[model samples]
Target: MLAAATAAVLLLFLVALVMMAAAAFAFAVLMLMAVP
Candidate 1:
C-alpha cells in the first residue's frame, strides 16, 4: 500500500514537471516571435 501511494505521488510530480517545461517552452517561443 505504501509503495502504491509513493508511485502515485511520483507520477503526479512527473506530470507537473512536464507541464512546467511545456509552459516554459511555449513562453520562450512567444518571446522569440515578438522579438522579430
Candidate 2:
C-alpha cells in the first residue's frame, strides 16, 4: 500500500515536471517572437 502511494506521488511529480518544461518552452518562444 505504501509503495503504491509512493508511485502515485512520483507519477504526479513527473507530470508536473513535464508541464513545467512545456510552459518554459512556450514562454521562450513568446519572448523570441517579441524580440523580433
Candidate 3:
C-alpha cells in the first residue's frame, strides 16, 4: 500500500518533469525562429 502510493507520486513527478522539458524546448525553438 505504501509502495503503491510512492510509485504513483513518482510517476506524477516524472510526467510533470517531462512536460516542463517539452515546453522549454518548444519555447527555445520559437525564440530561435524569431531571432532570424
**Predicted structure 3, TM vs. truth:** 0.98
Instruction: Quantify all predictions' global Cα lDDT against the true fold.
Output: 0.99, 0.99, 1.00
Model 2, span 1-36: residue lDDT tens: 999999999999999999999999999999999997
Window of ten residues with lowest summed lDDT in model 1: 27-36
Which residue ranges in model 2 land beyond 4 Å of their true spot?
A: none
Write the residue-wise lDDT of candidate 1 on 1-36 in tens digits: 999999999999999999999999999999999998
State the lDDT of candidate 3 residue by residue for 1-36, as single tens digits.
999999999999999999999999999999999998
Any residue pairs clashing in model 3, and if so which?
none
Please give the RMSD to the true structure for each candidate, in Å.
0.3, 0.4, 0.3
Error of 3 at 13 (Å): 0.1
Q: Judge candidate 2 at residue 7 and give its lDDT.
A: 100
* lDDT of model 3 at position 34: 100
